[model samples]
Structures are given as structure tokens and as C-alpha cells.
Target: MKGMASYSSSHGRLAMAGNLALFCLILELASVGLAHADELRVGYYSSSCPSVEDVVRNTVTNAVARDPGMPAALIRLHFHDCFVRGCDASVLLDSTPGNPAEKDSPTNNPSLNGFDVIDEAKSTLESQCPQVVSCADIVAFAARESVRIAGGFYYPVPAGRRDGLVSKESEVNQNLPMAFFNVKQLEDNFARKGFSLEDMVTLSGAHTIGDSHCSAFSNRLYNFKNTTNASDPSMDQTYVSDLKSKCPAPGSGQDPTVSLDPVTPRTLDNQYYVNVKSHRGLLSSDQALMNRADTARMVLANINSGSMWLHKFADAMVRMGKIEVLTGTQGQIRKSCRIIN
Candidate 1:
């Protein structure tokens, strides 16, 4: 009798432990499912808004054709939107009576554009499927199409992202990477958004297409830090001379603008990496990629290979599009992208 009782007690203990372990495993799996519950998937709109992508693609194609610079502008708009509030289309919101929005931020105000393209796409989408799609998704779709139009290949963008209601100007400064950031700072900024060093190097390749205002990098072309009159010593001398011709000294005139990738300013390609390797990077933050060995290796890899950077850039953009997305009824889909619904 005593032996039988002891065996029963031991079996009971083992059973409880097994049950506890199994419960923990279940909890872990559940948490993971909840975490990715809103995972964006390609063809998300196939059933609901089958013609949505077509509308957005045509809109972006027309816009980019009108102004070749529009592709970069659209990409920048998406980047700005994602970084601050996780690709929520908050950047598109205009200031309200009681609340200021992200679009009003100094960092975004002058730099970000291409709102018209998004609005046009949204109007078309609404005509086809009213309130079924989101402005956030529209922004993402436009961005992907813009990349395709700009010489970068088209990669599928997972949709289902909803628009965010809040858009604080103050949040932009803390979130967006600055043009003057060093390699470490750039890495940290991307890291906060769940990006790797390689991802950082890859997305920076977007600079391959587009022009930046002279004010963004005037310091790199003129008396850098008031310590030298010849501009940033790290820059290639010839490139510096060329930039000086385009930008001139600050007070001489209104802030001018220069192409980010002089070799192929209007083309989206791996040439940006080549420029980075040659120290022709327009932004100090761009040149800073070479300050670290790991990123420098990525820069070299991108420069050495053709089409490789484009593939990497597309992958990085997809990853970036997933940052802090609002889905599963988390946020409302705004009727007009500029105002919360």
C-alpha cells in the first residue's frame, strides 16, 4: 500500500510539471501569433479591391513620367511616413484646430512631397472600393510603384495597413535620421526601427535617385564646422568642387539644390554605392557609411555588383514597410488622407 501511494505522488508531480511546460509553450506560440497577427501579405486586396494596385500604379506612372524627380519624392514620402509612426500614413495628415501634425514638421515640411499622387490614387481606389482600402496602404503601394518607375524593379508590397489618427510634429525630430548623422547614429536610427546594418546600407541606396536641397548638406560643401574653408575633408576634392559650383556659398543666394547621385541623378541604380565608395556621397551621413568596416563592406559589395543592390534595396523596403503597422482594427482608415476619419 505505501509503495503504491509513493508511486502515485511521483506520477502526479511529473504530470503537473509536464502540464506547466506545455502551458508555457502554448503561451509563447500565442504571443508570437498575436505579434504577427497583422502580417502584411501580397495580394491582400485581390478580393476586396482587385483593381486598387492597377489604379495606384497608373497614377504613380503618370506622375513620375511628368516629373522624373517624383519617384524619389514618393519614396521619401513613404520613408518619412514610416519612420515616425510606423508606416501609418500619419505624415499625410494636415494640422487640425487643436493638433499639429507630422507634415508640419520642419524636417518634413520642406522636404516631403508627392501628396498629389497619393490623393489621386486614393480617389481612384475609393471609386472602385470605397472604405475597403486605406490611405496607408495607398502610400505603400505608391511607393513600390514609384520605385518600379524609377528604374528599380517592382517588388510586391503587402497591404492591409490602416491610417493613424495622430501625427505629432515633435516626434519627427526624434525618429527620422538626419543628413548629418555619422555611421553610428545612422545605424542606431535604423536599429530602433528593427533594421540591421546591411538594411541601412541597402535603403540608403534610394538616394540613387533624387535631388536634395543645398541646405541639407551645405555644411559639407562649404566651411565644414567653421574649422575649414574647403568643405568636408572626407569628400572627394573634385566632387566637392563640382558641388560648390552647384550650391555656392550659403549667403551668396537662396538655398540651391543638387542631384544626390550626379552620375545618374534621375536613375535609380547602384551608382549611389559607387559614389559612396568614391567619397562623392552628398550628405555627410552618406559619406559616414565608410567610417565603419561592416557598412563599408556593404558599400563595396553594392558598388561591385550590378542588379545586386536593386534586389537588396527592394528587400529592405519590404522590411521597412512592416514597421509598427496598424491593423486588426487598431486604427481607422481615413476618408481623406489629409484628415482623420
Candidate 2:
């Protein structure tokens, strides 16, 4: 096969056949053909759902244009989905009478939006292709399109994931990382998900675009580590004051939100690393990346090289999309994304 990707910059260019193969092999992506039958492939829907890419692109483009935050929501929605049930769209499932779903978990609740986007895309695919495209694949592809719109980093999403049948609120916390995790905790969390220290740091750079409720980080502002009225010393004092103005102390009133990336909250870029380096990162987890030598090295690399980080981020996303995914006959293609069909 011909080279599948290339990148060029004032720094240099990499378009050779050997480079592409090495990168793909490293990423464990695009294992084409039935030989890797259950594995995902870049063009799995070439004949089955020929319009898959365009349909998702149109749907997400309109949504993001309407709401600038939609890109973050979609990107996070994909991450949350993959973390829990391996990109099976379990996060899209609605809560039944007795069983709550992952979406309602405190880690996710009220913040994880973009279900409508997935439903809308699935609705279109069902009408046109019908039962062929899985909700899991839709979530995965929608996430890739979302990244393209927000960061201009285009990555191929290998499809063929099947929707999962189970989504438990109980299972969420064990699988997902928390906001207050230190470097060791963060490394261990991603390691459990088959990600390296570099992968964890690269993926965390997605925080460049999102918003976080004050409730998520109030610990750092007031009563940090049982010290009343003391903010986290690692957090820049000016940024802390700015955050306090927006998010009143706990019990003050409604929980307002602040952008994850104060500099460019609408665009996915290396500004996240920039914030961490300045001690202005929003979440403790964001700020924590700079606490250690190895992770901090990764952060510095992202800070100095935006284009190269984009390439790494896309590669990480592709690897993430393959996590414990259900394909072939392992799971069903849900007729409606919200319910098991």
C-alpha cells in the first residue's frame, strides 16, 4: 500500500513510505483486511456506509458552528466512552428505572454533553444505511471530525466497532481518571488503559478547548489540603484570583464554570501545556503534568512544538479508539443509540 499520511513544516517534512509504515506499526492502527477480522480498519465502511465520514462531518460541523463548545463536548464524550466501555457508545445509554448509566456518574454528570450529536448522526445513518453503522463507530468518527473542526488535526478513525449492551454507573469510577490525580496516579490510570506516559500526556492536551465547572476544582481555590483560605501554591496566584471571581467558594451559589484553557478555550492547541508551565492549569490533573521530570518533559515538548504534538495526539486518538472494542459478532448494532436494541 502507498503511504497513508504525511506532514511538512518549516522544521522539516516526513512523507517517505518507511516512515508511514513505522508510525502505523507503532500506533497499531489500520490493520487492514479480514486477516485482522475483528480489528478496526480505516475504511471499514467503504461499501457498507459509504457516506459515513461526510455524514458525520456535516452533522458535527453544523453543531460546532452553532455552539463553539460542541467540539470539546464531542471530544470528551468520545474519551469518556472509550475509558469506560472501550468506545462502545455506552456513555450514550440512558438510565433505566433501577440501573443508572455512566453518563450520570459524578465524574461525567451534567458536564458530558453531545449525546444529541451522536443521536442525530445515528438517526441519519439508520435512515440511509440502516443497521450497518454502529453507534460506537459513530461516536469514534464524530470525535475525529470534532478534532478536525477544533484543532485542524485530521486523523483517520478505523471503524467497525459494535455497540455494547452494558453501561453501569458502578463501573465508571474504576475506569476513568479523576481531576485531582498526581503524576503517579495519572500515569497508573492511563497505564491501565494501555496508554504510555507519553500517550497520557498527549491526550490530556485536549483540555486546550473545554470548560470545567467550578465544582470540579473548588478544592484548589479554598481549603486546599485542609488549609482554610489557602489556595494551591502551585497554581499561579493571579489565575487563582481570576478563578475565585468566577467560581464563588463552595455553598456560595450556583456552580459556574471556567474555561480549561483561559487563553484559547475554543481551539485545541498546545496552549494547555503553556498553561501548565505557567502554573495556571485549571484542574489539578492538568497542573500535575508538570510535577514530574518525565511528564514535564512531555509537556515541554508539546509547548514548543504544536504541529508535531498534533501528529502525536492524532496517533494517540487512533490507538485509543481501539481499546477493548467490540467488533465482528461480539456486540450488536443498536437501532437507537439510547437503548439496547
lDDT (C-alpha, whole model) for all candidates:
0.87, 0.89
Q: Please, what is the TM-score per model?
A: 0.88, 0.89
- Model 1 TM-score is 0.88
Q: Return model 2's CA RMSD, one decimal.
A: 12.5
| lDDT, model 1, position 292 | 89
Pairs of colliding residues, candidate 1: 82-87
True-structure lDDT of candidate 1: 0.87
How well does candidate 1 score on lDDT at residue 37?
Answer: 33
lDDT, candidate 2, 48-143, per-residue tens = 889989999999999988899999999899999999968888999999999999998988888899999999999999999999999989988888
Model 1: per-residue Cα lDDT over 1-341, one tens digit each: 99999999999999999999999998895565446535778999899889999999999989987898999999899899999978889999999877878898888777789999999988888877989889989988888988888875889899888888899998999999999999889989999887888999899999988988888998887778886675888899998888888786878777767899999998889999889989899998899999889999999998888588888888888878888888877788887888887
Cα error, candidate 2, residue 89 (Å): 1.0
Worst 10 residues of 2 by lDDT: 1-10
User: Best by lDDT, which number?
Assistant: 2
